[model samples]
Target: MEGDGWRDIKVVRNPYFSLRIVPTVVPMRYLELAQLYQRLEKTTLKTLKTRLVADFLKKVPNDLLEIIPYLILGDVFPEWDERELGVGEKLLIRAVSMATGVDAKEIENSVKETGDLGESVALAIKKRKQRSFFSQPLTIKRVYDTLVKVAEISGEGSQDKKLKYLANLFMDAEPIEAKYLARTILGIMRTGVAEGILRDAIAEAFHVKVELVERAYMLTSDFGFVTKVAKLEGNEGLAKVTIQVGKPIKPMLAQQAASIKDALLEMGGEAEFEIKYDGARVQVHKDGDRIIVYSRRLENVTRSIPEVVERLKRAIKAEKAIVEGELVAVGEDGRPLPFQYVLRRFRRKYNIEEMIEKIPLELNLFDVLYVGGKALIDEPFIERRKTLEGIIEADGWIKVAENLITKSVEEAESFYRKALGMGHEGLMAKRLDSVYEPGNRGKKWLKIKPTMENLDLVIIGAEWGEGRRAHVFGSFILGAYDPHTGEFVEVGKVGSGFTDEDLIEFTKMLKRLITKEEGKRVWFEPKVVIEVTYQEIQKSPKYRSGFALRFPRYVALRDDKGPEDADTIERIAQLYELQERMKGKKIA
Candidate 1:
């Protein structure tokens, strides 16, 4: 290839995502991944997406296996690794301007039309002024190494160095390559190659069982290493993967059940109803005297919440163990504080002890994944609870969640009421025989929140206000994801709950993310997430999402969540069915 394009890879197109047939002499190139990304983006069939990744993996050389998966996932490092490029958006814009020789204002104009920074950069690279007639081929390894350097840069003039490095990189990248580079650097590949797809892909590429690959991925939380192990060591090696003490595994997720009776019925008449605390979900790892804590997203937040670490260090009976629990920030009155307060404590880099004194955390242990040098994930829920009961002697600061084991709906309702009376969110009804499956939402565990639980929705489009509100957005269109297609569909519009302060703050926050404007209504790239409370979920033709939220009201701006983290169309339908049931309607 001529110009500043990547080289040395042969391509084979497959109906499903697949490995390209590369000659032994030609090492894998970044172009191959870029092409795969393009193909993955074109098709909405998730099965094709899985095959595309599998095919890509089949052609990956053993040495590049570990690095390529991370690139494909758009993560420079493993999921548990905390390193980031540290380059800000303004700096990125400068880098783009320098690489393309396009005016910064012109690039911003392109963003308005293209609706995506990556796409605008790709368009800009078409007009790159410093293009070379013949340049060294860009390789995945070079890009990965360069990005690692960017992440490693720190303190005093680091921004300048990062900007220079990024500019040079974008200058070297071809139009298509630059598009993906922009997205990769921003950690928004948008390739629809979620970890689940890659897990299945690895299983198919290596002929190992999908369950084996999933277990390995779940335990390690790194597909690059899992792919490497699957490719080099096969199933035997994958089976060897186990949860380690310093590494944080993805926490098991619960399904949302509309009612307590429904959850108990799913759990074979008897279940464990534990109070669901309104707080952050945390995973604690104890190895000897040191303890590390991780959030629900596998973020390493040990330093942010020191009290949890010290408390766990002294509370655990075993030297090596991993447990999952909720860390609720309680107020001086002993009532649980809002999630925002605990979030601040979890995010503080300095004055952590000061924040701890102001917002004390109470740990309510629920499940144990590992203990006494043994992994208990394969054990039944009851056995794991029994093991957890034996592993920790609760001081007041740390205690197992209060729970009730009963088969009667009346008893379950009473337990739930007691929990709600205590100002908790609700109760978690768990199947006694269910085994813990990491990063999965299944009937094994069901969440029962009273009445209608709030929905986390993404803002798809917004309308500017009139008169006094003309300076800010007045109404916002909400959207939910369709996991199968990876598309966002409109569910409702919210305008009622914002204060004047909220309107000003939200308008400022969303202006930069605007994609296109049609009169007073402006479209967005689905970046901002807001929690919405609604009276009911009703079937409607007003939105393509097939369901809509009735009388929706804005709750809070969920800065912690992204579009993917928002609710799904499937959830909307589930809630709709639940509402119908509550109205005493019978299904055919």
Candidate 2:
């Protein structure tokens, strides 16, 4: 396509809100683009001139002028794909190359001349050509598949390979196609749309309900599956795929209960209460001698916790089994240590043996997922718990979690208080008849934290920060639930808990959605939901809603939750009541 033709399509694909203008499509050709540019008005021509220059400037090595466009656009980096590339390395290489255009051999001499690749790309593009190569059609499925393939092929030490692959993919793509390709590859869509937006788009494209799409995604974690099914059997094909046994399902979460009484009430008098441990959630899969340890997200973490793998291989009686449990670090006294201590062991690289010696872990078994090559997810919790208890032998390295079956909510509440007194989080309330359902968050499993405070907040806006927060979004402004109007009311802001690196990364992220400016802040469409943590809940007149959180911090961004699922003002009031009651209490 002509450069102008590509630019026209770009304009059409990315139109400003309230603008209904459309561009004419023309045959792809450089000469045609040149002609179109010549016919354009001075103002239009001036706007097109910069991009044309930028395209030319990007030929330099280590120039961000070349890298920024690619990052913003999302294109394949054939140059870096020889291996999987870390976020830092990829950005550095792109920046360096765009800045100096010098070969590696000449970088030492040119480094002083061009400080960074981004600067170079910006400078170069300002004076570079308007057109060169065109890109392939971009889609979310393609981007996700490419990442998976990269992860599969690169294994562990393939950073160069990954970047090279990305370069090759984007080398010939048109600038606009390149943009989406780059964004998709990074697993981010900064165009004022949250991750859920893609799910919504997929549902609309497939003509199916959001729930159907969600169920399919939960089962496969593969966006391509949805697209494939839509292409084959239409949206109905999504429903055709049902939850199957023998396949691991997402475990249910629990709410924190303040005391034994509280636990019993939530569980409706009778309940199966398990000691909520301060540890990591692990799913052990065993097939014959082969063993794998997966995290709650189904990520393969076998290598990180080899000791756990070895223990599973030795302790489990079944030849083939999959079990869910908590892996906690234990002190010499045999008591479980804090979760942070356990997490340090996960991040260890050098001196792993020494770290392992210092931080021994104990696996607290809960549910058995599979046994004898048959899936146990369809089985009731009581049956699965029995099977789990029967198969795993308690050793110094592994033991079954402390569990009890009680008919009174009072007993459950007592256990909750004991768990807290032991420096644990809270208790897990599970339905005895329930089966494991992977990736689905529902009331079947409720996590009862000690605090009554919970807020249902909507993401109203986000800001880009400096240093490490330069690229991704840094902090967000969360709004409260307005019961009367059923709308989100701006309440508080959360800017802490983010690392310097996160600030830089997220800043670049939020920049893409920079819409209209409001004083020092930029507003975004309310879409994302996040569950935040706080020391206490207090009434405040500063916000539109009379509430505020003390020491509020980002807990987890809730992609599964829609805006409507957020906590209400009434719920916040309940939490405040609990907080007040606990303030004056002195444990005997």
Candidate 3:
């Protein structure tokens, strides 16, 4: 046992390797969680996923219940917490190599082969050359706390320190645990377990209704805390977790609609049509003088746009309120600029004043979730919109979104055209009687945007589809030809608009063209062409092309076209310029 890297705790001076591993306080072993992750990954059934999680949560001690949900969701903190591991794939490979005494190049090759960093790390840990004697079995609390410490590390020598901590954890983790650990840290734990499934699990574990759990999650934006309260105090405790003024509520999302006529029919004819500005989705929370701004992903972005903060503080009449809106960047002509301009402001950290000068933003307030001491989320949208309008005096910087209450499709269509002519993306149709359902894409709201131009792009890569399309390719990574460089540059990924027959045909076609495989991504020879229709072209560094298509959907396979004949980057630039020129122009 001495030479085999196993240590007896009695003989070891520091048994847990600098970790405050309190044996008595340990509630659930990480091995158990890892086992659950395996089971979840093996199946795609929602019911099975719910049963597995519910059964696991039922066995969790109340004291450790809070972190369980977060861990299962592949995060140590909630989305609104503003903290992240910040460790990239390179750092992870280095950490895994350091722990397992494997060559870094070998680890890289393994990742390339599997297309999954977690799976590669897991395999490395299983075949490690050396291990520490005092390696302790990981607990849920221990793993969560250690990961938080890793994320919180910053400044000089933080990378080395993070690597050390991660290596230590890897030493203690079993192969399966290491697999899930890497996935969790990388924020790619695709175990087919969604938050909706987790909500159901929490409800099942506590013997409460799923609606209660979802309501609690919507108001709090924290499923972990929701699970704990439900486990301890049941429904009564859950009911207490209501909307807070300064805390961001998950903004209610809308489903896409084919047209205004269909949207009106879906909402019983009578509906409220509001201009859907092509900008950032913002949720503004105000308590006294403090105003917090959150993005659509629930990331705290208060510091990015101070102008919006000042405007909210000055305009909001109530002492405490929560409002939702679209933040658009406008040019000197007082016309809305492209969404990309606003995104630049959103991403700007330093040189805020310069960015503000470069791009002035206007907040088009729409829905109010809280006012004074009352929670308006459960209230009707009509009432909420009224409260929003009543609480804020319309100003240049902040104003309620231009809305018209209509029962006719023709009226809605006219309004939508006017909005589009005014440079907005489209219109949002809302049921007047529907309540504000935070974090849900319920039938209460429908988004209507007219069809835009389609691009025939080359298939550069594809990912293995999940659930029902598990055997076929579900999503595709498309690229445009860079005429200058003679290279294909990625623009966006599309997973929608494919028929079952298309999926089968495309899967077979792409599989045959696979140049290489890595994780879920399969690099193709770029010989295939596909037609894609998108809402708008925006400047984004997220893709290699330095541009991305918003809501890009597949139109059809361009068998008539080849990769060499695909759209060029020049065309994308021209389209973007055309869109910009159309803005602030009179639509005669």
Candidate 4:
């Protein structure tokens, strides 16, 4: 019993180091973070949680503060980094089973009861059949290093290596630490500490303004870097953060308008309207001759679209710039296909050239954020548009999106009809004086489609299929993101709109995400984003979001989006209210 307590508090020297790093240390126990997790779980007040994290950060040693931010986020690297633990649930269960000397069957049973692998690990440790007298207390440095090592492991028997590393952490952890350690490795940190909260915490901890911290985060898209910057250089360093060529920024989002006339009115009786193509949003960054393309979600997609790279390499006239556009999938007749066709090309890791030949793309440049070593986010939209138009040497494969500047509703409506006739979605309206804002959704920009009411929802739970549809998930329980709580709450479920081919691909993709199953009902980890259409919105007691979609139909799988980018519960409320006002009017 004394050894057990000793193993929870005593210092253990970390055996991991890189040849490049100078061996910076935190001088804290991993138990500190686990304790913070416990405290965060005990409260639902966001202010309290933010204050707790701010206090914890204020006490940290500055030598290696970067790792702590990512750790608290349950990630080994920054959000833009491609590295992940890549460890699935079964591998985690095996690691827990191996560490506690608990049988695999019993651990599985525990998972069934708890519905959380982390909790299962905590419970299994109590009945341990193995013990080590020489085991030392785990340090924050060791735990962080070990999981990062797990992420870096690849090629040939990597699962065995990942299992061994995780098991070692478990052997050294106390029960509470074991619970969080598992969850962190699985990338399911349930602390409700969203990036927004952490951003606020960094500001509070360092006595810097929240806006400065937010600007730095928006420019770099890396909270780890922001934390270290705030610690080392304070407010001055944070204010100086600028856009880099390779790192991706979170793209700006838009709101929806009822009609072209309404869009014109919202923009003060005049607006810049451009065709909104039915394609994935693509961000292009260039430095010298090198160029990188990113998807809407800031995913590095250079390898996925080789021809786009070639086209961009020769199309842009500037030596350094960051531009954005729509990369539409085009058919043999040169008509644009749906956005999923572009997503299919982006997701392919093998036979990419063949897929490119099968589905071609057209890049229509729209906005420019950076050029000549200066960020243009502060520039007015009209100026940015002029800059974008001047730099791009347009060709058939790559060109600027068609636009019309007008204050007349008749012209805007004609332009909208022309866009639809040209096989595009509709038109996007932007205020001439609006500045480009990253990761923001407001009235600065608006989307006006013929019927633009689709919602991007994440699948939270589902039911198994029946009869001929028995091979795949028959119905999916969908939820909208709640930014306030950092949770996805149920809004509706859809059992229709899936093609036979969709079922086959969905079965292959979703079987790996099964957390726990009960008869025909299965719960998922909220990874899959899908576009959905509904007849109307209704106040309902059946869903946690307090609203449900009427006759919801699945549109497409948004493989390009993550769960965080899904429509928010607030947005659903707005849409519901909008529908109520249009009760008598016929909606397209």
Candidate 5:
């Protein structure tokens, strides 16, 4: 794992086109790896990492540092510096050379000419190999860590150095290892395996209940922690772990209540209903002097909303606290702006000052999970509400979410209409006595959109799309989960609502996970879940699942969800039933 091992791997993997250079004095394993590449016609990052690790552990007597670079950066030479190359650029060159048997120099020249490394790689690979060798397995945690490290690095470095590192890592990987590495780099894995697959794997591996894994994931958003514990303690340690606050619990989804009154009815006739705002979900943590803001995906977004961070520091009256709220952007007139407008502000890297001035945001506070060094997840909703209200002083920029204690469905309905009139989404009903459940979406809370219904679809198959989508499989065929067999049955295909930028980004991402081809189509491992919005749901014999969504559009990718948590067929049936109920009630 030393630096030199990485350098050596980078050299071998960095060839422009196919080269028949024999190693002067390399280990047998290294030679074996190269021969395997020659036989397989291609190698991936995941496979390389696994082989390198296994080889290292097996005392294979190879230069692991040289191998680490090959596995991590795709560089196999001793002279390359990873600091000089961009991860994407390195991957592009390596992919091209591997697929085409073309000289790495030719690919690099093409990349330099077009300044489109991704495109060059794609073309090279396409011309070199008609079919992919294997699919890589990628997890979100690994990618997140890698990106964080990438972001941490500083200074000007040549793209070639970076490529060398990435190329070397991938060239030395094994199939399964490559699968994980590729998935991580691409940022999505559609293995058709539910989150339950990993959960079950972890549970069995550690000997802990599935519930504990769920709880831990909810609390920390760290799957690696569970895996590590399972590796070390052997299940008993995992079972003994308790869920605590300040550890970051998952945000609960607001339950849909057609009217404020209906929400109260769901809460047993008298309940607390909060006005669901049209804004971004934000989780704020204050560790004494340090304040951090995270999105629902647990991404560190403190830099994106420095204003909110400043506001929280002033308004939150606690020594140490972790709270959740909705971040709403407002116009100069002081009214809340559209959610899309708020999102645009976050997406921008340039002219941030101008954007912030043009689209100021306010934080509408909701749940409080920690205060004064104590966790509040175990507290009842009512108690937590009181604690939150007591700790935060509402200001022009930060305010408590509007709520009402109601007894009848009619009253709840009235509030719902008022919120809609204010251009809000809808209402969120919570069980007054419920505890904060991390990583679980249940009846304790539900989300009711203002207009069209939302479907929590499980992604089944994705095709490598055209134009900008040539790299990642852009259009996804989604399905409803079958509870009995624990499978995803296709319901519809969504190809709209994605920005061109997103299309390009996703294409590069999806390409790495492709496992097989069917005629002109490529298949992937389905593990990602996305929330889709549609104009209507229709019964269909054409789709594999016997259903379809009209005007289906991308809403957001769900990182917090597990495949088991995807919308089930029974839930689809419930939506249909609810539609019918609404029809009958309306006619009456």
Candidate 6:
């Protein structure tokens, strides 16, 4: 047992690399990170968690520090990057089963017992009867490199190859290490160490202010790069991080308002109101002749919308700029379609050209953040609007979002109603003196939508949460009643706008009504009623209801209402028709 303990702590020399590579001689073992994971798992206090990660990061060598942030996030690449491991739960289970000589049935049973596949694999590996003698001990770099190779594997027998790489890692990983290795692969490393916590940890570890770390992260959208900058050049190096053409920055966000009058009041009795077009938020980055489009999540979607790329190339007169807009799909009559049509086009990976022709899009330019190597994020809204208007030559398909500058509350309300009448989602009210703040949901910007359109839906099911929400069900499966059939049909899932206390309370309520369990999803009897608000009603075939809700958010528990009192499919249909008629009248 003493010899085995020493072996577990021992840093084995790698047979894969030559002795000439100095770093290979002192390879950073995976045990260090595994130990950190164990500590973080046990350390529930936020301050203690941050301290553990900060100390752990400080111990990592500078060369390996670059990937540490990504590793901490349970990812190899930044969120903005397009690389995916493509390893599903079943594939991972197969790999684990193969590596440990555990029965596939035993693994499936373990998964059923434990809500998480990571925990299941760990249990299985701990009880495994066979072990490989020739396997090399895992290292942090080796694990990351193998996953990247798995992500790069494609075309014919890719699953087999991915499984093989995962098996290789499992064969060498100790039981504790295998637990986190599985979680990392599944992208559910639930140590409660999110990006924000990691940001604070990075600041503390490098002795820089949290603001500088945040700014560097905002500009680059890559924690790996931010960590590298923090380690090498300190605060001065972080200040050098600027808006570049190819890298996409996080889009600024807004808080929803109850009323336009309230929104205007929040903006000091005056605000710039723009029609909130019901479409995907897009950020266009132009460098020389190259045009790239990024989604709100900072995903590169340029290839998905070729027509938008071409239109933007001709619409913008700037040499280099980063502009934000909404890409709304248009009907054959040139009227903007519902947000779902645009979303479908955005999601398309194959036959994209066909979809582009079938569903034409109109770019609605709204804000400018960067131009001519200068970041306008610090500029006031009025100045940025001026700069945006000055540079863009609006064409029919690439026009600026319609706006109304108003100081009076009545005018703001009227403009908001007009925007909703025009089939827009809502009105975005911005303070005239506010600067463009990326990744912030401050009071500088407010989204005003009618709250009278709330729906009382039944909770039919729920899925287990991850990270900070690991113990409770974070999102609830919502359903609308089909009165004709007397059955509940799923409309969508609601995961946002719930407080931690609410989640805990609801989780206890859901546990009592659970009728069946399938993986992380727990199907409950339709007893709990909740009020929900959504941006739009979209036609979708993904749900049995034949409809879906866009951006669904929790309002409050409708304790006064029963499942029978829940909103029906008929009501949903009526809302959809009413929405269409409102848009039609505006078009006419």
Alpha-carbon shift of residue 86 in model 3 (angstroms): 0.4
Candidate 6 lDDT at 121 equals 85
Cα error, residue 454 of model 4, in Å, equals: 0.4
Q: How good is model 5 by TM-score?
A: 0.70
Question: In candidate 6, residue 400 scores what lDDT?
Answer: 85
- Candidate 4 on 63-171: residue-level lDDT in tens? 4477888777666777556677898878888988888889888888887677777888889877777778888888888898898899999999999999999988888
Model 5 per-residue lDDT tens digits across residues 467-569: 7556556687787877555567888888887787766765555454455567556555455678898877778899666677888999876654545457877
Write model 1 residue lDDT over 183-296, tens digit each, in one string: 888766767676667788889898998999988888978788889889879999999999888787877777778688789889998999999999888888898998888877
Task: Please identify which of the two predictions, 3 or 6, would achieve the higher lDDT against the true structure.
Answer: 6
The local lDDT score (0 to 100) that residue 371 gets in candidate 3 is 86
Local distance difference test scores for all models: 0.83, 0.57, 0.81, 0.85, 0.61, 0.81
TM-score of each: 0.84, 0.63, 0.71, 0.85, 0.70, 0.73
Cα error, residue 363 of model 1, in Å, equals 1.3
Compared with the true structure, model 2 gives a TM-score of 0.63
Off by over 4 Å in 5: 1-86, 89-102, 105-151, 158-161, 167-184, 188-194, 231-236, 239-247, 447-452, 456-476, 480-488, 494-532, 539-546, 551-570
Misplaced by over 4 Å in model 6 are 1-24, 126-134, 256-270, 332-334, 408-414, 452-531, 534-588
TM-score computed on alpha carbons, candidate 3: 0.71
> On a 0 to 100 scale, what is the lDDT of residue 358 in model 5?
81
Point out the higher-scoring one by lDDT: 2 or 5.
5
Runs with alpha carbons beyond 4 Å of true place in candidate 3: 1-26, 254-272, 405-417, 429-432, 439-588
The parts of candidate 4 lying over 4 Å away from their true place are 1-26, 94-110, 123-134, 461-474, 482-487, 499-527, 539-546, 577-588
In candidate 1, where is summed lDDT lowest over 10 consecutive residues?
Answer: 1-10
